[model samples]
Target: MQPVINYLNTNSGEIINSLGQHLTISFIAAIIAILIAVPLAIILINHRKIGELVLQITSVIQTIPSLAILGLLIPLVGIGTIPAIIALVLYALMPVFANTYAGLTNIDPLLMEAADAFGVSWRFKLFKIQIPLALPMILTGIRQAVVMIIGTATLAALIGGGGLGTYILLGIQTNNNNALIVGAVLAAALALIASGLIRLLAKVPLKYLTFAIIGIFTLAGIGWGVKSLEFQQQETITIAGKMGGEPEILINMYKDIIENDQPQIKVKLKPNFGGTSFLFKGLQSQKIDVYPEFTGTVLQSLVKTDKAIPHRPRLAYQQAQKLLQSQYKMTYLAPMQYQNGYAVVVRRSTAAKYHLHTIADLTQFPALKAAFDPDFYQQSDGYPGLKKFYHLHFQNVKTMEPALRYEALAKGKVAVTDGYTTDPQIKKYKLVVLNDSRSFFPPYQGAPLVRTEFARSHPQIIKSLNKLQGQITTKQMQTMNYQVTVQHKKASQVAHQFLQQHGFLVQKSSKR
Candidate 1:
């Protein structure tokens, strides 16, 4: 209770801003869905034949997983509000459109014919008769859409669409129950508010309800306009980040440096961009200029070779650098000193019980249950390779989101799980990381990856970025992650403080 209270107090401004974003996203998406779905429903009502197909198409879209839709949109729209809004609009369309189509098509033929016999305009007939009669059903559809959009809007954070989900994602990643609950509660509250407001319309006079709806939209528009002003710019340099605390911090650091040093470039950050493959496509399409990437990920996934590389960070970085340059016209910048490799971790109690100290110790526990993130589960350095190298097999190997794995281990749900060496949760949960004696997992030293052309064009920018080389250590990164995830600090604030403390960013004295 104290943690939750402290979280709310500390993050009040952020929560307010996130609430605005969440509402804005859901409202706009519902509006867009309404605009399209209602009009299409009207058109289709007259052409009953095509209405079935249109509703079915929208129904199919609703069936697609929200995360999958967001994933599919990232390569196409390159993350942020655009992709998030597009996906939400698609999700919102089904309920609103289906109800609208049903209401309009199910209208009495006698009334419509009377409206026709009155020599009224199709537009007039719709507004005067069809729309008024369909108002209840239409409003119900909108209410459903608004509520649905509120829920789906949380996923917006996965693709850099800032909302309450920011707190949720960070909380899960950092294992902060307070932040997660706060975010979840806020999102749910917003949904309830939207539903209650729409329900209010049912008890009001139709004319007043029309004005109330207009007023709601008008206020939403104003809120959106105000928020847009804060981020208004024709950004030239877009720094992207994959999902996770480390990448977000890196992108924030990059944004701070570039905007401070090269103001003319108009830097922007697209955080929570999809994983390696998605970001690779974004770079190829010029949707992103630069992003933080891991050396092992580049070598294993992007470069697409299973050939073993040198274990030393410098050697591995050089190998990845040469390969990326030759094959993809991409360049790797100076590596951050920290290595965020996969840690085969177990609860301290489990480690003590099994006398586990290294990967070889894991071989003794054939019945151990292992869990990992999807990417790790499929990667070369993941379960399969680890099993082959160490001649060990877990009784069960489960794949889940990286964030959930720590919680699972903490609850003793699994004996072992994959983890990043630099995750703060490792310290929080008092876990033991088995030493990779066999060197099964590759070293994943953090580094920035950029298009070769982009790097060449901005040599000075590259020079400033190189200042970060070998700056962040494993402990420093873990603490920073803890600060944001556990302490609820802003990523920009955390990054700025780190840079200033380390002499990378000099603080300007305030004028009296």
Candidate 2:
């Protein structure tokens, strides 16, 4: 609830902006659908042959799952609010089209006779008689479409489109329930509000449209004023994953950097310190500017295949850099000193009881549940590839969060979890960090990903980020991890302290 309230309070301005945008998207679609559907409905009501085709076509559209529609648009249109809005508009069309036609054509024939007897033109008949009678049913269709579009709009967050869906996606990634609740509630409330507004619009006197326009403009100005004043200095950036162990360490470092040493940059660094899929999309779509990525992660994720031979960090980074440049049209710059990748760990008690020292011993424990970080190394390098490479497999394989995976081991929930080699908890919890013996996991050296074009214009961004490569050692990352997880300092505080300790601050930071 605190996160939800914080999100709502902090993002009222964004919500306001989205309300306008969402309305524009929905209204435009509704209008177009009505224009097309209503006329078609009239023609179809008179001509039975065409009616079946039209209904079948709309049903076909309605049958396509909403997620499929959005995913289908990704490669064609890429990502952002435009693709999301377009997909949502299509999702909304059928209801309005079907409803408008039904309402218009369903009007009683007696009313048409009375209008004809009065010598009313088609325009007058539609305006004064048919429309007046059809308004209730038409509004019903509009209301349903509003509800459907608003629900689907949550999916927009995946494409870098701004909406309440951002909250829901954040909530899912962070394992924070408050974000999900706020996203669900506010969107539901907005749908209701839209329904009410449409009803009120129906009652509004025709002449009052001008007054309504004036009021809308006045409110828009006020909204802009509120936005300008409220979030003026706030900055937002995406982190790109949720629950990977060392990656979470990277994000915590960033938060630590922003909060303790640099106050001038007020950042709303996003919640992606887990898996890179969302971040992958965000970066490709130009939604994210930068994030901590790794040489090996790149070799696999962007390069699209795991090499049979694992190379040294430098070789891996150089090859991945070239691949990213040529394939993703992105740049991979600098590598951190530390190396981290898949290590199999077991509880000290479990290890001691069974003498679980290596893969040979681990395979003996058949009853154990296994949890992995749900990404590259764990999926392929740690498990599937390991099975193929070394012929090993645990009976129960599950994807899980990094932080929780520790507790899962401690509590005996899972006997093994993929861990980074230098994780501090390996000492704290007395878990046995087993040797690969074969080293099937590839090298995962850290690097920052900056877009090719952005880096070309702002070379300093690459330099500034690259400075951190050798700066944060494996031991130092472990210490920072302890600060956030054990000492309970926020990630931003840790980042800032690390920066000031090492002098990454600008003189303007004096005020902060």
Candidate 3:
């Protein structure tokens, strides 16, 4: 079994990485949508038919499936946030534009006639009479648009945007109910609170006196909220997490601590999820307070030195921690029981036909096609290294989400694919996990990367996390994951149940 830390880190990190991409794209798109929609609204204000057509177009944009929309945009704009932002912006256009148009159109013609009678310029009538009267309604539209974008923006992760949706994606793929519940609930709450505040402001009768009062109060409230969520309370402690794979293990465990543990501590998630380069950058930036890290990965990426060592688990743990402490001022905490490293997965049929028992045997084949997780870093020491060391290369290398990759591998869309050594699908799919003959992929010992400041300020957090050491066997992690994804339980509920069953938490609260 691999260490518990590695298992969690590998699983949970992908969620945050995806989420960051999702949020960045959504917010930018919302802003662009507001900009484009408002001007178009102003132009079509007097034309009822054109205004209707604009609304319909926006509605149509909203109707398309979000991933489909993103895919459609990718070819034209390429990968990452620009195309994603455009898609989200198109989605957000209707509410703002529609409301603005309605507010403008609803303005009394009598007022316009009266202003014209006094030789009031058209610009003056629009700026003074129409706009002033329409401000509240336009704000209402904006409020609606904001809410829509917040929700729809979750899909931005499918492309390459970043935001809060990271948790949602991880929770979904790993079947971590707690992660999902937290993500979904927070998203809904954010939208509700944001929209509610917008409504309250819009409701205030337009007055110069109220504007200053409201602005001051709003700013104060924002400051208060930020401080409240920050300025760690007596119950608060920091948590660090990576972007993909085993990060889930630690996150779920931390989530369980927050949810069901005794002497509760509020969790401040310092999530650092991104691609390999991105995660290393996050580590350099100190954006992450703690994260699950692998032994060999630490050696290869951080040390940038290759010292051939015996394939011993304890040595991997010691070496990984040593590098983190000396180089990063990061404390490497107690490792979890289970470890997750690379494994070759293929259809049950392929395994049987080829009689493939190891990476070496599979290399004998020609025209290899494989799928790898895009978020997975160190494909070099893992899969790509396997290729180079063994002198094997595939004809096709497809990159996709881990979830989608399974289906492709199963259907023979690809001959073999990458997988977690412990993923339960190895059982469910009846797939084969080929052995590593030379053991070229060094042991990926899992341990928590604890920031020095956090260790000083909240040592208890480490001790609390340490309790799960030797608890999360690969098989255990796999089964728990199955309960959530295949069985479709809520991530929060599953985490709580697992903690209780494992005796990590006593007097467990019944599932909510």
* lDDT of predicted model 3: 0.68
The TM-score leader among the candidates is 1
Model 1 is weakest, by summed lDDT over 10 consecutive residues, at: 503-512
After superposing candidate 3 on the true structure, give the runs of residues whose Cα lies further than 4 Å from its correct spot.
1-164, 167-233, 240-246, 255-264, 268-288, 302-311, 367-369, 373-378, 393-401, 506-512
Tens-digit lDDT track of model 3 for 1-512: 23323434444544454444444455566667767988888888778897898789888877888778877775566544565577768777888888888889998889878998999887988878887898888888888888888887766444434566766766666545555665677578767876897878776665763586567658757966997876655465445555543454457667566445535555555443434443444445544455667776777677644566447778887877777788778777777777677777778788788887888887778577778887443456666677788876777777877777887877778988888777767766778888888776677757666677778887666667678776788777777656545554434456667777778876554434
Off by over 4 Å in 2: 1-52, 199-202, 206-291, 304-311, 355-361, 364-367, 371-378, 388-408, 419-438, 474-494, 508-512
Q: What's the distance in Å from true for residue 324, model 2?
A: 2.1
Residue-by-residue lDDT tens digits, candidate 1, 1-512: 88799879876866787888887788778889999999999888878779988888998998999888887877677866788899989988889998988888888999988888989998898888888888889889999999989998898877667888887876776567887899999999989988998888777977887798789878877977986775575447788887666787999888777666766566767666656776787787787888998888888778855668777778889999999999999989989888899888999999889899998898778898888899878866687788788898888889988778888999989889988888888877878888998777778888889999989988978987888888799989989987776566767779888877877755431310
Alpha-carbon TM-score of each model against the true structure: 0.83, 0.77, 0.61
Q: What is the lDDT of residue 325 in candidate 1?
A: 94
Model 2 lDDT per residue over 109-144, tens place? 998898899998988887777767776776678778
Error of 2 at 225 (Å): 12
Candidate 1 vs candidate 2: the TM-score winner is 1
Between candidates 2 and 3, the one scoring higher on TM-score is 2
lDDT score for residue 10 of model 3: 45
- Span of 10 residues, lowest total lDDT, candidate 2: 266-275
